[model samples]
Target: MKVKAYITLKEGVLDPQGKAVEHALLSLGFQGVSGVRVGKYITFDIQVRSEAQARDQVEKMCQKLLANTTIESYQFEIIQS
Candidate 1:
């Protein structure tokens, strides 16, 4: 199975990188850019036998190391391909 993960800072969290990107966009004449936020996307190939297992393991992985749950949020999906 293949897994895809998206980790993002929760709403109300400060995102300096997103802010910088927004500023850069505005600088390049792309106006109306009110806000911007950034996140991470991770994909992996795994040998899990079932979707449930993949989801469980990936969720655990994210909670344990891929994300800081106190200050951030993460969501993952198991793509059976």
Candidate 2:
């Protein structure tokens, strides 16, 4: 199975990286972008038989190390290939 994790800053959390990107975009004359938020994307392949097991393990991984649950939120979807 292939796992794709998207980790992002929680609402109300300050993100310097996103801020920098927003500023840069505005400076580049992209005024349509009112706000911007940045997040992380992680992709990996695992040999899991079922999506349920994968979801369980992935959630554990996220809590243990993959994501900072204190200030960040994460969502993942698995693709079988």
Candidate 3:
């Protein structure tokens, strides 16, 4: 199974990179832009046979290495590949 993880800053946490991108867009004359949040997309293959197992392992991966958990949040999707 192929899994994708989306890691993002939690609410109330300041995102400097997101702010920079937003500022750049405003400087480039882009209008109607209010807020921007930058995040990370990570994809990998897991050798799990079942979706339940895959989700369990993926959640462990996120908690252990992929996300901060305190200031960051993560969501994942399983794709058959």
Model 3 lDDT per residue over 1-81, tens place = 999999999999999999999999999999888679999999999997799999999999999999999999999999987
TM-score of 2: 0.94
| Model 1: per-residue Cα lDDT at residue 51 | 86
lDDT of the structure predicted as candidate 2:
0.93
Tens digit per residue, CA lDDT, model 1, 1-81: 888889999999999999999999999999899779999998898898788888889889999999999978998888778
State TM-scores per candidate: 0.94, 0.94, 0.95
Query: What's model 3's lDDT at 23?
Result: 93
Residue pair clashes in candidate 1: none
Query: Alpha carbon lDDT of residue 31, candidate 2?
Result: 88
Superposed on all Cα atoms, the candidates' RMSDs to the truth, in angstroms, are 0.8, 0.8, 0.8
